[model samples]
Target chain A: MLMNDKVPLIREKALWMRRTAFTMVHRAQLGHPGGDFSAMDILATLYFGVLNFDAKRPDWPDRDRFVMSKGHATGALYSALCAAGYFPEDWLQTYMQPKSLLNGHPNRNYLPGVETNTGPLGHGFPVATGIAIAGQLTGATYRTFVLTGDGEQQEGSNWEAAMVAGHRKLSHLTLIIDRNRLQQGAGTEETSGLDPLDDKYRAFGFDVVEVDGHDHAALLAVLGAAPASKPRCVIANTTKGKGVSFMENVASWHHGVPNAAQYDQAMKELV
Target chain B: MATVTPTAAGLQDCRNAWVATLEQLAEADPRIVAVVNDSVGSSKLNSFQKKFADRLINVGIAEQVMVGVGAGLANGGRIPFVSAASCFITGRALEQVKADLAYANFNVKLVGQSSGVAYGELGATHHSIEDFAWLRPLTNLTVIVPADAWETAEAVKWAAQHDGPVYLRLSRMPVPDLDIPNRTFRPGKAEVVREGSDIAIIACGTTVHLAADAAEVLQAEGIHARVLNFSTINPLDEAALHRAAATGAIVTVEEASIRGGLGGAVAEFTSANQPVPVERVGFPGFLPTGSTDWLFQEYGLSPEGIAAAAHRALKRKA
Candidate 1:
């Protein structure tokens, strides 16, 4: 767990990550900024305070693995990876550009910190479950973590993986759902209600926990806990766009890029 | 009506051979693990599970998770063999196969058991005639349909040693051992069963034996049809196709659909490279309920049907 003296610095880093995510999406003129902002704090806390990894040796055998199941939020992941020194900060300038390693979705072949290629929803969760299974078989102490969007849970594959993970009792695996409530076309409630989400995970045999997604200290505390006998599911309640006022909780902002004025105002507000 | 009898003396089930080879490979390598979807009995992995209890991962009927788990195991430096029924593994988890294995280029072997109408009486839902069509287009995937027990064992051994994704299609149907013992299985290479000049009969999996029988029948009639067994489908042996084209006529056969199985691959290769008189032999649509033998005969997948197709191709030769 992070010490009290370092908690403020981690919060400050999370704020910086939000700014970088916004800039990447704004420059690309394309990206899921809403989910990016929503999951920024969780990503920052996992990379900085929780995950046991080495940026220099990304493929370290015993290192903890992190998979971003909501892969549309590449901006947030790229910012976190850069902040963790996985790549030079200058790489951020070429996000989504032609010949840039930074694609709209993370490609594990191109990126070092990326554990696997994920774009299609409900895929990373199962892959993470398999990784956790491997960790168990090898008796390795390393853990596996995956982050999924609230809307992405509608995919049936997630349930398939959830059932197996629960049945296998992969205690080393942690699944974090960025519950922003809004999806692409409408709110998750209007589309397909996932209320009682914590209960649903608990039924799937997970040790469920809910947290304020933006609170860095809370995220660190919850994510840093040791594994129990069952898989852990962290339901991070969040606003769709955490730092931007106009985009926050707005359903249309799920993929809506801010215009010049909106972008300017958003940047000023973040500062 | 003229009735045709299978000429091969002894027949062996490829599934048994696959399991035998899998056990040998697993015993040799500790990194080898079997990931199944509660298909241990169907995949002939009961012995493997019993022997390597800790290594067998049965995900209990979840095909998507089974494939994903295989990919994850591969990432953790374990060679995962994902075994399941072909219909569910390929049809239900097509996206996982595409993303987790092929596109990601994971070191996993997908063992699709009971492929190509092997479960004929169970109905069309259980038939896996579309596996070739489904898997052929995916890049970085080596698609193989071994003809018999020997080929299946060799292919399984090759897949375990190979460092990339491979789909090994095994059948519940018993097939004659066409391959010589200790022959090395190479991907993208076709084995010539017999050489001739009138017309070439190219086939794979269940139809390879039919092609061989057809070649014998044609020889008695003085047709002298060439026989080419194509175990590997995706990285197709174009060189062999060109050699077959020299015969001026070709008849392609498979136990799968004519759309994208061995027949489709042969047509695609021949039409573009060498314009030859070609006749394709295989099932066209969803198979009706029947015994495996009845379905094979009904769909013109028999030896007599293949020989007739060869006769038609010989007529078109100019």
Candidate 2:
């Protein structure tokens, strides 16, 4: 129950999540491994130790909601969901197949844990804000969480939702920006400098917190705190491919699958 | 083609009917809520907002957020009616509509006000002439363009209980109410206003009244043209369309572009099922500076223009 005592369990869950995600992507032959790796630890912490959810009753009205805004990292979220007993772990082997429920992105219609259908960038944040607003309206005691890619911050709609969230002072909402530095092609700084990300969020009435994305203890500590009266934003600083030795901080690995030799080496490194 | 004079002036803005019906539904069901993009005045939701201020969510000019929030509210077991200008709501937030409401199948009603050149003097930027074409292609979205105030009220009531995504296109333009005798609004059913065998005159939205007037002109010319009011553009009443095609000629009119609207829909349906001589009456392209009436007349959406198109279709039939 205590945050400190849960670190080792969460770390083990995070490793399993990374391994499952990598294996799914490798078998499916199409995925964003770098972003998935960067976001896995956060997903593990939330599903395992931070959030209140019932996998058996995914539609429980009082259950907390999570939206994976960086939808390309579906592998990581799927891994976490499987670990949390949302679905059969055997289903992960059929990901991205012809008729699999595990689509390239999250689809709420097909999967129960997916709160909303989100693949297009900058969409999940506003939807999460709306969910938070609903919680406020009905006096429901449930929190809403959303994760977005660093490159996805360039969309103007995110700011639009941010303005509404700030104006409404939706304290039940939490937004996590996967600040892994590398986008698909180049670094985010080289493309669209987001150096003052914290100031921008703060100006928009968010309680901004920066944490090491790979550190389960730090993530649990920051993400567990409640907002005073405004929405919360967690800037998770991370390496693109955190666990793999060759792929860490590499831009090409954003969506690239590893070869057989490289895959074996990466699996060894993960262990 | 002889021109017939326009009808007398007993008209009501459809937005009033929409707001009245919405308030009634919200009163009965606590789950119904209204979401707007700073469009309370334009959408005529002031009275409803006053009645249930807590349920009225004003997202302040952000169309994307407005729609996204509607989906979220629906996820929370609240039925949200999202109201905004047609041009901005459908054009700016089309992806959100496609993904959040349609694909996700959320119980959200999208009310597009001032549709189909209703904001006539505001120029092409304000024209929602492309809404039908844009929304019809997306799956799982029921597209309804109510012809008058009674139909608008009925459509809003129906959308409230439908339990799926709906796009209700309401107009600011005032037009005489066509007598829809058994006026229940169904998703894809066409109302036959008149019966004949010479030809069929199909119309919808702001142009249905014009089609009725055109039928009178054709009748005077000894051509008894049937008149059909097609309120639902998608999931089109193919049975009614095929029956109309049996008359050997059809004239379709609308307040939107000649392509991909009521005219295009009819043409596509008829060509695939029953090929008949078809002539489409609508705006060929963007309009110049003019009132809605002037634009309607200039772009062959008037009763006289519709009559002329009927003659052209008859000639092609011959």
Candidate 3:
């Protein structure tokens, strides 16, 4: 659990998370691999390094809450759940199967650690704010972390939540924007520019931090710091498809499942 | 028993009842939280917010985020009632309502204030005529429209005790009391305000009293019109609707749009199970400007309008 020991372990776990995500999407025949792969490192780092949660008790009142606001990245979340021991690692294979609980979107009914169901954009941030407010009301020490896609930030609701978080001064809440720059249709800049994103959050009363999203050491260091009297937002500048060569920076891979050859190439890249 | 006078004398806005009930609940249970979308005064929650400052969450004019935050509060074990204007809460943030509250099956209560045409002069942008239609199709959501202050209090209590998601539409328009002094609310069960066999008038929310007045007019015409005040729309009292349809003629009324409100619910229910002649009374579409009372009269929502619809449904003339 020491910082020196945790950093390398989280990186390996991130790699495993990507591999499992790729395998799950391949089996499901339908999933978002681009954002999942892009966000895997942050997910791994959260579950392994920063979150004060035990997978055994997903509903622990005082446990830190994690919301996948960018819910299309369920592959990354499910993979992190496996690594965090919420479910068996083998459960990843059943993802998006006819009746598999591992749906394209994170479902709280079937999955542990999923605070809310999200698929349509800009849904999670407000809920994350709620979690933070609940903690404040109950006097619980647990913090809330919400991971949203940079493109998903375009949905207005996220800014609304940012305003609320600042107005309420939810010091225990942290928002991590997966600034992979790419969305399903195109690059976030081409679709709808979210640049000056960090400034936007800062103006909304957050203690903003810009970090390398894929670097576990830097993420852990930044996230480990105590939140000030206001909510903290970490704009993690990231690259889509972090591990795979062909899929990296490719917007078409946003939801396209890897074929056998591509899957193999992804698996090789992870190894 | 107060004999259920169903009178609007000393009528009170149900939004006030919401604030009173919410304040009472917050006092009793610290976990009871109210979340509003910068509608503190609009939702009549300023008193509650002042009393329980920490418990009131004003997300500042964002309906989509307001609902999502309510869901998150539920996730964190605080029972949150998200309060917002009905038009924006249901129309603007509908997907969040579907995914966060219903699909996720959270224990959040959605309080939609100023429903129907309460904001009449504000036009369709502020009138939530389509809420019933938008929410009717979602599973795991218990939709309730309180007819008066007492019903609003009862519904709030019921929603707090209930274990799942619920949508409670509280009106700014004043309504007469529907319940006895100590009457309580029962979700999914329609309250039969008056009984007759000639024809049945099914109504909910602010329009229930209009239906009663229509029944009185029908009685004057020697037509014993049955009156059913339905507060719960989603759980649609199938048995009651069937019996109403069995009466051979049915007139349904609501403060919402005719397309998906109580009338539509009844039609959808009776069409599949027991098809019958039905007259749905509500806003058809394309709203016009006026005061609430004026709009209600213009849209044929007055007692005379209900009676006319009843006559249309029951009369045997070609």
Candidate 4:
């Protein structure tokens, strides 16, 4: 009954996601493990504790939709979907294989629960806005959510989408920026500089909600809230590679695969 | 010889037919919606904004979001016709057109208005000569270039009911309706506008009627030419191409880049499958400052120019 009760379940899901995602990356030797770990808690909290979805009916019209704008974090996305029961657990074994449905990016046609295909940054927000607009037009109760990386905000398309969501007053839309600070080569502050991110969303007419992205209870409180008068933007402050101490805050892990001992160390540290 | 621009009076701008048909379809299907990048007047959807105000989404000169939003709208069980100027929609929002609409395989209609050199004297940046080449490679997206007002209406209806991603490349130029009676709308099929065996002229969009005119000129010279209106660029009616190739010579024409429009597709299909003498007539590249008629005349898009190209193909056949 307590909101805090959901935290433990979310934490368990997050741990499994981190471990499983790291394993998938370890086996494949090609994954954005840092991003996967950073975004795992937010994805876990949404799938396990906050969002409303039915694994059996991924195309259910009224179901809430989540678009992963930072699509390279397929380690996080695929693991969460599998745990959410959208597909079998063994599906993760074939991740990025010869003809796997689990591609490097989220493809809606190949996999269920993937709202759209996105390998390119700055795509999901606009698509999610369209989905929200559709719901608003039909007077449907479904809400739409999109997750983007902090550095991904440098994409002009996200700003373009932000302008629309703000102007249309898309009440049923929520945008979560995974504020991991670090990008591929450097921190976001040193890269494109999104320090005024909260203010930026506010200027775009969003109801800004800043939270600790890894804090399950706080994430639940904001993400689980009902639709607002304006489109909501949750700036979830998170550390890149949160679980593994070695990978944490390291930009090289943006697309780094783990070695044998490193994998073992990460697995132990995740729990 | 100077040719009449499709935008000349007493003819029809295909955008009117497109918007009219879209409004008619939207009336019956509540799922039908229009998403524009602040192109209400240019896309001829001002009345659509008036009648179905809520359904018309004006994204304000943002082509990328306009297209991505169409995919999202389609995901929400609504059929969206994302309309914008041909140059911006195809050029600016190209990645979205490929990833969101085509690669994702969303059921969205992307209507491109004022295609070709419709924006005459506005410089090469506004001309969508390379759109066919750019979009043709995206095999998942069906590309349709209607010849006139009637075909524009039919293509709009067809795109709405087709249940997949379709790129309706339209022109603001005024064009007379094709003389073909009982011409039904087929997605990937070519319509035989005129019959001839000496040489075949395959054209699409604003050039179909001109090809028909060239047929008459060839007829006066006792050289019968077949004119094929190739409305669909991707999924080329190969059966038709084979029949066109059977004519021994082929002259392909369009208001697009010679490298990758209807001409390019026909040449690609013919050279590999059936070798024949092929003459491709279209823009060379970007152009100098000129009106549509002057540009058409300069770039060999007129009836006389097309007829000359047909003769060149025929001579090569000889």
Highest DockQ, which number? 4
Q: Which lDDT tens digits does candidate 1 get at residues A1-271?
A: 3355557777888888888888878888898888999999899889888899999999898999999999999989999999998999889999989989999888887888998878999899989998999999999999999999999999988999999999889999999999989999898998989988999999999999999998887888899988999999999999999889998988777788878898899989997
Give candidate 1's error at residue A223 in angstroms: 0.5
Candidate 2 lDDT over residue span A1-271, tens digit each:
6787888989999999888998998898899999999999899989987889999999899999888989889989899989999999899998999999999998888887999898899899988988998999998989999999999998888999999999999999999999998889999999998889999999999999999998999999988886568999999999999999888999999999987888788889887
Cα lDDT of model 2 by residue, B243-315, tens digit: 8999999999888888888889998988888899999987776777777877888888888999999999999
Please provide, for model 4 over A1-271, each residue's C-alpha lDDT reduced to its tens digit, 9 standing for 90 to 100.
7777888888888888888999999988888989998899999988998778999999999999999999999999999999999999998998889899989998988999999999899999999999999999999998898999999999999999999999999999999999999999998988778888889899999999999998999999999888879999999999999989999999999998888999888878876
Q: For all candidates, state DockQ relative to the true structure.
A: 0.77, 0.82, 0.86, 0.92
Residue pairs of candidate 4 with colliding backbone atoms: B6-B173, B6-B174, B7-B174
What would the TM-scores of all predictions be?
0.96, 0.97, 0.95, 0.98
Clash count list over all predictions: 0, 0, 1, 3
Which tens-of-lDDT digit does each residue in B1-318 have in candidate 3? 001113366877677778888888889987799888788888788888778888888877788888988998898888999888888899888999999999999999998988888887778788889999999999999999988888888899999989999999888888877643445567898888899988889999999988888888889989898899899999888888878877888998988889977888888887899877789899998688777888888878988999998888766322
What docking grade does candidate 2 earn? Answer: high
- Could you tell me which 10 consecutive residues in candidate 1 chain A have the lowest summed lDDT? A1-10
Look at candidate 3 and tell me the lDDT of residue B112.
Answer: 90
lDDT of 1 by residue, B1-318 (tens): 111233346877778889999899999998899999999988889999899999999999889889998888987889999999899999999999998889888899999988878777787788888888999999999999899888888899889989999999888787887844456677889988888988999999978988999989999998888898899998999899999999999999988888988888888888898989889898887988887889889878888999999989988999
CAPRI-style quality class for the chain A–B interface of candidate 1 = medium
Residue A125 in model 4: lDDT: 97
Compared with the true structure, all predictions reach lDDT values of 0.89, 0.89, 0.87, 0.92
- TM-score, B chain alone, candidates in order: 0.95, 0.96, 0.94, 0.97
